[model samples]
Target: MKPILTATVVAALVAIALPAVAQNASQIARVRGGASCAGCNLFQASLSGLEARGLNLSGARLRQADLSLTVMNRTRFSNADLRDVEAYGGVFSSSNFSGANLTNASFVGAYLQGARFSGATLTGVNFSGASLQRATGLTQSRLNQACGDEATQLPVGLSIPRC
Candidate 1:
């Protein structure tokens, strides 16, 4: 009886963990297959070096994900949670990130030409050497909440605090 009870508990724990694992796998599959996975649970996903253009991942959770060197041009990441993501050298030209939470994300040397950031939270985001010269919807107030290095390029009359 004790062995049976132990087995039941183990099975229950496995059942609880499987859903999260399966959900992550399914979300990764959908994104890799060029499907728009809105509001998907992609926490801590490793999607480095992928060149998926024009993806719609609005309201998705991409916290702690590895998006290094990815070319996600024109992707829609509006309202997405991108906290602590490592996106060094990623090309996100013309992507929409309005209302997204990008707290503490690293975008070092990223190309963000014409990206939109209306109402997005950029607290503690590392934009070292990132290009935002053509980005839109950024104001002094929004830039005040974020930090960047001297090499970080921004639109004229807009400056970012040094990280």
Candidate 2:
């Protein structure tokens, strides 16, 4: 009876730990797979300092993820859930962010030149010190929903609302 109880307790602990282990393994697999995390569930993951040019991250769940200082030029982030993400100092030049949920995301000191923001939800997004020069599909309504400082460089003919 004692051995059976111990075995059951061990099994219960293993079961409880398996999900976390699996999550970590999944993150590791995505990182190992050349930074292409399309349709991956990377919620609240710390992906800072990743240098992955042209990374395909479409439809990925990056809610509250830390993408600080990552260099992801021309990455595809269409339809990704990026709510409350912290992307400070990241370089995402020419990336496709169409239809992404960028609510409350911060891109402070990031370089986002020519990145597309079409159909993205930009409520409360912060672009402080970020560059969006020549970016496409940005509307005044969306810009109004976002916040930026004077250091935020916008596309020609487009202006940022007072932050």
Candidate 3:
């Protein structure tokens, strides 16, 4: 190929890659200094080790995000879309996930003590070996699939399963 043609192809590829790079820069910027990204669509974004504790991320679309090993304690994720998210080993203690869609999210061995999942859809979520102490509005089905203790709270007339 001629030098000009090679340069043109490289320039085209760089043009295509520039927008993605800029978008990633913005994502990093927004996560700093207790940023709150409400109503933003962050589906399938990897937010590992971002120190996003206590941020108000309500109504954000975090579907299939890799938030593993992140310190997101006390973050508000009410009504957020978190379907198929990989949050294994993440510390989500005291976080509010009320009405969030968490279908098929993997929370294996996660530290979710006192997290609220009231009215949240937890269908097929893996909470195996997770510590859900003092979690409010926890359904029996959710607890049955995960590891919890007697201190875990449940809805009215819901019996603890043989988990």
Against the hidden true structure, what lDDT does model 1 obtain? 0.91
Cα error, candidate 2, residue 75 (Å):
0.7
TM-score of each: 0.85, 0.82, 0.71
43-92: candidate 2 lDDT, tens digit per residue:
88788888889888899888888899998899999999999999999999
The lDDT of model 3 is 0.75
Residues 17-127, candidate 3, lDDT per residue (tens digit)? 774421233553586555888876676777876677788889988887888888899999999999889987888989999999988888877888789988898777777
Better by lDDT, candidate 3 or 1: 1
**In model 2, which regions exceed 4 Å deviation?**
1-24
lDDT of 3 at 146: 41
After superposing candidate 3, which stretches have Cα over 4 Å from the reference? Answer: 1-28, 141-163
Candidate 1 per-residue C-alpha lDDT over 1-67 given as tens digits, one digit per residue, 9 for 90 to 100: 3445588889998898774542387898788777889999888888899899999999999989999
The collision pairs in model 2 are none
Off by over 4 Å in 1: 1-23
